[model samples]
Target: MSGVGGDDEHIWRLAVQKDGKIVAAGHVATAAGGEDFAVARYLPDGRLDRSFNSSGSLPGTVVTDIEGGRDQLRDITLGTRGRIVAAGSATLPAVRGGTSFTVARYLRDGSLDPSFGSGEPRPGVVVTPMAANDDLDLAESVVIDRHDRILAGGSADADGRFDLALARYRPDGSLDRRFGDAGKVLANVGPGSTDEDLAGLALQPDGRILAGGSTAATEFAVDGDFLLARFRDDGTLDRGFGRGGFVITRTAPGEADDEIFDIALQMPNRLVAAGECDQPATGRDVCLARYLVSP
Candidate 1:
């Protein structure tokens, strides 16, 4: 489901069958709230999941319409026992910066899982920003690990720069400190660059990690470049993956102008990266390339 309308509109997180068929989808539009938006669900085969919110809709009470805040769902992943986990952000007066990262879990039947995170299906996991300036911190991606742990990735600016921040949570919605400091890790990437940020992340079946984003020299817009880093399950840099667990993809001949928005893994340690490349000659095109992990 997707919200269609204005700046506060959002789409519903969907579930698909193993055969690549969309079983259910629904969205809560801003029009339903006058100025705020809500979440909805759909059933298998592109129909509304009526089981959700009595005809497929659920409004958030934490961020009320009177709070001058907006709520939106970002990504969703299915969990064990028919549980669903979703990541998003909501602005609230109670929070230090008026916004906080939200994660919620739902039962297979589309009901909020009271067993998770204070009975809030959304943000079954929660990680508030460290400072007031971090009102925009949000979780962009989420995945489950072998141990039933949940991993989340996004950007934050508590220290200074907009660096990549990662968090891990137990299935019960508690933080996982074994992965990073208080279940969170941050990487600046480009110390002197204008804007350093992480875009996407993936976990290798073998317990390795890959994160992709952009980097620049001196400033974010002066000359951008693609950046990828690989880490071990213990959160240590994977020296064998790239140059010290890092790969910088830039325009051929070193003009230094490109950005990576997504990445995927192929068999036998082969990887495919997709994004945009501001090549000197090609100007810019949908960038796609393959790379083999170095021996």
Candidate 2:
């Protein structure tokens, strides 16, 4: 389940089964340079799985942060052979504005797998870029397909507003060019001033793609609405999604604001979104609901 604390110090991440059962949960409670550090384990029933971590904490490792301290885990994907991979950002000192795509892998026992990239030395172990760019780029969502292909959705800053970014990687951590340009692609949904984001993503049973985020209404302000886009396997928007490939949602009446923090696709083509909505003087409430793909 996707959970965020009101304190703003932590965005709890939990892995749950298809049947509404939570398998693991974790969060980063400190601002250790804003790095993504969290711990989690399987749940036997509704409690923590003692087999992984009795105390419920796992300290991740990093080989290099060419970008310094802005590392964070925005999403996680189960890896082949029973492993977990989290994707987010790594802050590279101010010299570069602390922005870099970052990923980390952990073994089934919740231990940092020394066999992955920059991991422990093994025979013929190779590593490559999952998805990287010069300017500000981040991985906000990730998942492993039935074939074990690593799919990710995120945002990349452009001249001003941000654009949707998608990429796929081989199980070995190498970029898959068959998906997009050098294994990466970008999309601009609306004519916004200085803001855009790819917040959550999910893969359909047939291999189609669904992406969600928001587009700024203005350049100097946060007057924007949430956006959801569906894409074909070729990196093109699926026109049948919302309207010409996308849909936008916002808080009714506009007394406050609404933002979609996460999204999940249910059976057929229905979608579920979870987020927080500011109810003016009432403060913010945890908002959760589902949407249908209108014809």
Candidate 3:
């Protein structure tokens, strides 16, 4: 609500700078068309950093693909040398029907990094993985790997059902095909009959990847359990953890729908995740789960 916009706006994610400054990222609604990635920086005392983007905030877009459709920033992270990396989804304006996972990087001065994702062909160099088949793709969280690579986590529509999607890119914004299948991995947590999403991601000290979200068992049903998965550095599922590298916790099982909105490491090989749970009898409640990180 701090933002001045008559239309609906949102601050999806934020990150802290090493200098104690704050960088906030989200989307801003435009009068001419769709939303654009809106980013701003603030000093420790809460004063807007006038030096950022040469203003309180970048007046125009910092990153986008679709000129007439929506773009939303789901998460941001502090990268090497204090650079800023952002992840979200951009609607495909040229394609009449879908969205794509979008990412962008900015220098310390808040200027777009030229070496980052600049698209020319289908996922040629952009943070997005090229879509061989049409599907709505979205990036909900992002983290920097030990090698300074970029890893994105979210959901993708596969045959109309949402599946956990993760993409890894080099520091220069090029997809790392050596990772997942062609630089991306779509994990089916449900039976391909329900929805699933990766809401958060954490890169382990050993280069393993941990992702957490939610998934439902019933087809098309919203009620589900908190889902967690681990991946090796090479993007293959880790069979040692959970059941075939997956964990599902049902707080209310068939009685309510649960979800994980964020996750963090608790140190010493422990992880904690938190979100909201809804039920017919008891409105909404804060949900939390912690696990020993063996991956």
Q: Pick the candidate with the highest lDDT.
A: 3
Per candidate, the number of residue pairs that clash is 24, 6, 0
The lDDT values for all models are 0.60, 0.60, 0.77
Per-residue CA lDDT of candidate 3, range 1-295, in tens? Answer: 2453327677887778889988888887777667877677788998877676674334322434344568788899998876888888887755433688888788787777777765544221253633446578889999998788999889888776788888999887878899989789988874447678789998778999999988876632377688889999988999898988889888764548788888998985999999887766776788899999964
The candidates, ranked best first by TM-score, are: 3, 1, 2
Q: RMSD to native for every prediction?
A: 4.4, 5.6, 3.0
Model 2 steric clash pairs: 67-91, 67-92, 68-92, 70-91, 92-98, 114-120
Q: Is candidate 2 or candidate 3 better by lDDT?
A: 3
Q: What would the per-residue lDDT of candidate 2 be over residues 200-227, giving only the tens digit for each residue?
A: 8887877778787766555312555667
| Cand. 2 Cα-lDDT | 0.60
- Candidate topping TM-score: 3
Candidates in order, TM-scores: namely 0.77, 0.73, 0.90
lDDT of 1 by residue, 62-112 (tens): 111313455555666777875667665556666355555666666665556
What's model 1's lDDT at 121? 31
